[model samples]
Target chain A: MFFHIILERNLQLHPRYFGPHLRDKLVSKLIHDVEGTCSGRHGFVVAVTAVENIGKGLIRDGTGYVTFPVKYQCVVFRPFKGEILESVVTMVNKMGFFAEAGPVQIFVSNHLIPDDMAFQAGDVPCYETSDGSVRIQKDSEVRLKIVGTRVDATEIFCIGTIKDDFLGLTGDPGGAA
Target chain B: MASTGGEEEDASELKLGEDFLKAKCLMNAEVALILEKKFETLQQLSEDASSQFSQVFEKSLQYVKRFSRYQNPEAVKQVREVLSRNQLAEFEVCVIGNLCPETVEEAKALVPSIAKKDRMDDEQIEQMLADLATIKKYE
Candidate 1:
């Protein structure tokens, strides 16, 4: 889910980005610098919602750079250990498969997949039933539940499972040819 | 299906949670999925109060292995809300709500063994059937 969190950042503005459009430059720069980035304290900063307060700017002596302590509200996404998420399958290997739900990468081990589905090696690696009725391959959208999550300052790694009901491939029943 | 001595049927189960606790509780990989949400909620509380619930929490993790899939929490919440509104028993609601039978017969199948022994009335059965119809939306 998304959460509104207050985050403070010391934004350094280049002297060129000062003057008439100084605030505009700061706001745009804040979005470019913070959005899509992850912090240990606040998960993933989805967006720089609003600049709550822009404190007094201090000009550096030699660089002519202005440092502004900007307090802002942002929407953050942090997956809990048991949260269910839908993601698109990105890779397949003997160990398991990797999926991406926005910036979060989920890994579903073959051990956690349904016993009925098996791995098949070919031009495109995939998990499939012996009958070829259900297949999971690259680009497949799947519903998985997080069992473990490791959030780093830059990215989140999750161990997910699709072994439960209603938590597997969401698209058409197997476009297997 | 034959415990039919209606009148003196162990009044204790009527109080709360006893009948459901007594039901042999066989949930295969396909059906036990209804327990995932409850397990998740319990697990969260356990983490918050770590020592207090450690035993039960550990037991539940072992129990969850029987149900292969960890179901969608949103779907589980939606079904539970509807079941509670229909006035079903709390403990049993977790079982039936998660099983999420799509039809009256399907719903009936879940409790028939216990229903026979308990002599569950026609009205309670009807309410459950109706609840299932509404629960289908979540599935």
Candidate 2:
């Protein structure tokens, strides 16, 4: 899920950058520092929309650095347990297939897949249903339900399942619309 | 009688949970729009677009473009307006907008909270779905 939320971060600026371009420097620095970073608490910061505030700078006596508290609005993508997400399959294996929904990586174990879809080992590994009606392989689009999640400092790992109703291969792999 | 509705289910079972329970949601179309604007700004600032974008931003831009059901900004705004006018929560609004479920049954299955809350009856859901489809068709 994508959320537009306000987040606060303290940015440290060197004394050299304390001139007329200070605000621009801080905003750009905030973008560079925050975008694409993942926090266990806030998920992945996709983009910084706006800088809401820059608090009073606190100077450090030793380093000659100024720390400013910055509040910004950003778009973050966070997957929650039970959320349904459309993901593109990145790889397939006997253990399960690894799929990516934007920045989040999800592992849908073989057990989480429907029982009828048998794993096919080949140059291009894939899971196919009997009668070959459905195939889930690399680049396949699937709608799966997130069953569990583990968040690390720089990444979010999720376990998803397509065993339930309205969950499964959404489109053929590598198909052009 | 036993509770068959979502009341018996754990809050985390199909819920957004505490952190996101009240956070404003963005539809894939809106994200695509925002990212495109950011990209335009970045392109004006630097010759190398690759250097300015983080991997997450790049991936998200691609994903949103590919999955966004409504590409036209007008359509996107209208979709949100239609959903919000029906009193749908921000999260629910985006979920429905992103998924573009063809039927109410599918919508309810993908977002169980709508069903549990009884926010809309079957007829209203059908109407909302029709409204969304019309927007997509025109867009």
Candidate 3:
């Protein structure tokens, strides 16, 4: 004879896209996989459960028993990805433009600029490099992705690559209408 | 039962008073009684009735002062900010829907003029009023 215990309670979780049966199976698998996983520099699993579905990939915590939408396949737990720094263009030089995003002055290489866009001077109300190779306009929005980090005797620098999408211009991502 | 009937009468009087007020007619003791009853109803609807009532009352007062007096400067500045903030569009529509002015002409005439001090163009003011009309249709 086999006996199973089903508990019901409100849970604070994102709406799940999968049904209870599938979600239960997935959660069980995840627990089994991470049962003996080691935690160190990489990160480790925390907790796993199923949640109610609220459409648009949203799950909410409801009164007990994990409720998930009958669409999602699985759920996984992981540590935060990384940190994002915000900066604004201060000046544009031939090498790059200076932007201050959260007390850090970083340079955005001219090569990282989008294609077919020329650095026009005077017409635009922003600083332009002498050689016109690099230009940063005033009030231009920029997001830097952390690629590497460095620590010196008294100073700390974060090297980032500005090649990803949604890293330039507010509302410029996907060309908002 | 007596108290409830009295309360209903008081509420009816209050609704009548509000109608008169919206029509820009002078307030009378009887109309005041009716408005008072309407306010009582509002109070019953929410715990924060006083604050809500005050806000709506203030907005209505501001509209009357500017619309009746043709003082356009401060009102114009406010309208401009509303336009720039994209809030005016929503607000005007809501007002028109809520008030549901009898006729388009009445609604157009009710549009609050910008203050002369503000010096906004007539075209811009007209456009804002037109937007209000659009809201009235839905309401």
Worst 10 residues of 1 chain A by lDDT: A168-177
Query: Worst 10-residue stretch by lDDT in candidate 2 chain A?
Result: A168-177
* DockQ of predictions, in order shown: 0.02, 0.40, 0.01
Deviation from native of the Cα of residue B8 in model 3, angstroms: 74
Ranking by TM-score: 2, 1, 3
| lDDT (Cα, tens digit) per residue for candidate 1, span B1-139 | 1111222232113321222223222222222343344446546866763443323223333333422222454555565566566555543454454344445454444433326565455676666657556545445
| Chain A TM-score (model 1) | 0.83
Residue-by-residue lDDT tens digits, candidate 3, B71-122: 2334323433434443232223323322323444433332222223443455
DockQ of candidate 3 compared with the true complex: 0.01
Name model 2 segments beyond 4 Å from true: B1-14
The per-residue C-alpha lDDT of model 3 at residue B101 equals 34
Q: Is candidate 1 or candidate 2 better by TM-score?
A: 2
lDDT (C-alpha) at residue A40 in model 2? 64
**Candidate 2 chain B minimal-lDDT segment of 10 residues:** B1-10
Candidate 2: give the clashing pairs: none
Write candidate 1's Cα lDDT for A52-169 as tens digits. 9989999989989899999987555544454454566889988899987655678999999999999988899999988987889987877677666665647667788999765787
Cα RMSD (angstroms) for every candidate in the order listed: 17.4, 4.3, 25.1
**Interface Cα RMSD per model, in Å?**
19.7, 7.3, 31.3
Q: Using lDDT as the measure, which candidate wins? A: 2
Q: What local lDDT does model 2 show for residue A88?
A: 96
